[model samples]
Target: MYNLKNKTMKNFMTIALLLVMVNTYAQQVDSIKTTKVETVTDTVNGEITSKKIKTITLKEQAVKTDPADKGKLNADRIFPPTKVKKTVMVDYDADPFYDEKTTLKYFELNNDNYVFRKSNDGFIMNVLNKDEEVLKANARQTKSGPYYVVNSNEFDGIGFFNKEKKFVLEFYNQKTDKLETIEFAEK
Candidate 1:
């Protein structure tokens, strides 16, 4: 019984030693092969031409970087400040929201002589060159479509668009201390 146990232990150690030797040999034999093929096509004067390129790499070597020189930027050596061109920033006012393709809806209030232009979020109102005000409002979606509700320190209103390209606003005016209904038709 003791002889059988000894024989099995020897067999296991021999198999483990053989596996370790095979793994060590595989690590020592380090080589890589890569093949790349590229094709280019060109057409000139209705004539077609094609070119093929093939590249093969037998082995690759890893680049060794110094641990002491880690995180050291070579900015001054690569791009000197004197050789770099100074960027000139022109003082120009450009409106990003004003697109050439966008059609602005302009409306005039008949009773108050106030003109309003429909913007992205709200209405931009001008009272006959006397005053220009921007009223920010949000649209509330309903079954009838989207309706804008404007609530500000000056006035509070609920406005909706009609089929006649008119915006009807029912609002309470704080300055005049009156409830007013105004219609703005697109012009």
Candidate 2:
């Protein structure tokens, strides 16, 4: 009878230990699941969301123009080239690759406006614009004869002009503190 009791006690102890281990493992699994859920909730709260906006005020609308049409200067037809004052900067030479795309024809025309001849459905530019700023316009030979620039001096150009084909410019002699408008367009 003593032997039977000892055997029963051993079996009970083994079963008890296994039960404790199983409970501990289940508790670990629950803790891990809780941590994962909390992490997912935090991420959702931190994420930013954007919505589509569809509203415009009447004043913000733009005027519509014909799609298949070209605009021409109303000079002579309506507004005879209104004399306007503007600062013109002259650039002798600039990078053709980059300057050709960003400069405007009005600012780049040389003294002798470019002479254009029609060819291959486009005009050829025999000369180039002097104003580096104008030539930089991303303009190429359009239907209009090769772009030509008029002498700005004739348009009340900041009080400097070589009416007699004289090249005029101001030279600042820093040493003499003298700012002089040198007019020597005609030798």
* Cα shift from native, residue 90, model 1 (Å): 16
Q: List candidate 2 segments past 4 Å from native.
A: 31-187
* Per-residue accuracy of model 2 over 107-159 as CA lDDT, tens digit each: 11334443222334322233344542122111133344433222222221112
Clashing pairs in 1: none
Least lDDT summed over 10 consecutive residues: which range in candidate 2?
31-40
Q: State the lDDT of candidate 1 residue by residue for 80-167, as single tens digits.
A: 1111111112211233231222123345665444444445665555454445545433334334547777654555688788897677
In model 1, the Cα lDDT at residue 10 comes to 100
Error of 2 at 4 (Å): 0.5
| Over 4 Å off, model 1 | 1-102, 111-115, 130-144, 173-179
Error of 2 at 16 (Å): 0.6
Clashes of each: 0, 14
What's the lDDT of the predicted structure labeled candidate 2? 0.33
